[model samples]
Target: METKFDSTADAVAAALRELIVGGELGGGERLVERDLAERFEVSRIPLREAIQQLAREGLVEVFRNRGAVVRTLTAQDVEEIYGLRVLLEGDAIFRSVKRLDEETLARAELVHRLLGEAATTQKQGELNREFHALLYGACGNARQLASIRELRAQVERYERLQNTLLADTPSFQDEHVAILQACHERNARRARALTAAHLDSARRIVLEVVERLAA
Candidate 1:
């Protein structure tokens, strides 16, 4: 029996995103419209809309013969995504540090604590996004923040790979502590540099694993 959703395109997209990011739908796997429509209990219109949405987010690609396929990130794609992230997120962190408020920092601290206690990768990822969003919310540039979010979504699958494959990956908790401390001290330069380095570290690890997986 298929579960039915009172589904809009966004709802459908969210469901598909969860499956894709969770690795239930692996790279290059075809998304058959009729099957997905039946599974999601949605009309073909919204299902197609959802597919287009994921395509725009770079999680899916619609080819001529293949309607929609989960995208497989190349090493080059990972490099480009993280390269933009370092630049954009670094700037956001710099600006946000200068504007950091006590209440916001306290909230970030709580999220950081929760992030440290997260038992699963899924929980950790959710809390990690919340922590970063709290810190960067003071940047005063909504467009930049939106772009940062889009970039993050693009590489979430790769981030999962890093968490699963690399046993010796550095503690993001330690880095978050350092970043939060910089924000508390209102050290914009240090926060920016740390943000860049943190993203760069993940990029390197993910790129190495992606290459190894390809080989």
Candidate 2:
């Protein structure tokens, strides 16, 4: 059955993701289907569908009798995600920079400036992804970008630990500027190096929070 907020499973999943990412839904907390259905004004069918979506994203876990609970990510998960990011995004930016003109790099710079002015964590996250997409979309491989997007979605669980992790810090500001400058210079090797360093730095920043949570 469907309800006002449950127009589609994607809608319900997005609602649930906001709660999880914003930390309202604590890790390991059991998801009571009946309660959530009532709260979201949706029927069990769509609510279940939403939970399943989150499960695929590694934010939810389901068991035969125990039902679903928020997944508690481990330190290893952080390592694996960022490791893959280094490979995927680093290479994409390398290819992208080789192909993009200075104008495209300037477009990404515009977003980078707005990223500096973002007031909230949510806005910061949005601009950050936008900047990357604009910066790397020129990689010209739809399949590569699709995989990168999936990895990014998975990393959002860690990224949203923003109270403890660095989301829009000055370090990020400086780094984004540097990366864009490299792109402006049309230095594929330098851009790839910067991207790799950026991903590693991010892995370190988020790993601290995730490891403690794991322990």
Among these predictions, the greatest TM-score belongs to 1
User: How many clashes show up in model 1?
Assistant: 0
2, model 2: CA deviation in Å?
A: 23
- Model 1 spans > 4 angstroms off: 1-7, 165-170
lDDT of 1 by residue, 122-142 (tens): 777788789899889989999
Expressed as tens digits, the lDDT of each residue in 166-214 for candidate 2 is 4446888888888988988888889899999888877887788777777
Task: Please give the CA lDDT of all the candidate structures.
Answer: 0.84, 0.82
Q: Tell me the alpha-carbon RMSD of every candidate.
A: 4.8, 3.9
**Which one wins on lDDT?**
1
In model 1, the Cα lDDT at residue 16 comes to 96
Worst 10 residues of 2 by lDDT: 160-169
Residue-pair clash count for candidate 2: 0
TM-scores of the candidates in the order shown? 0.91, 0.86
Give the runs in model 2 whose Cα sits over 4 Å from its true position. 1-7, 101-103, 165-168
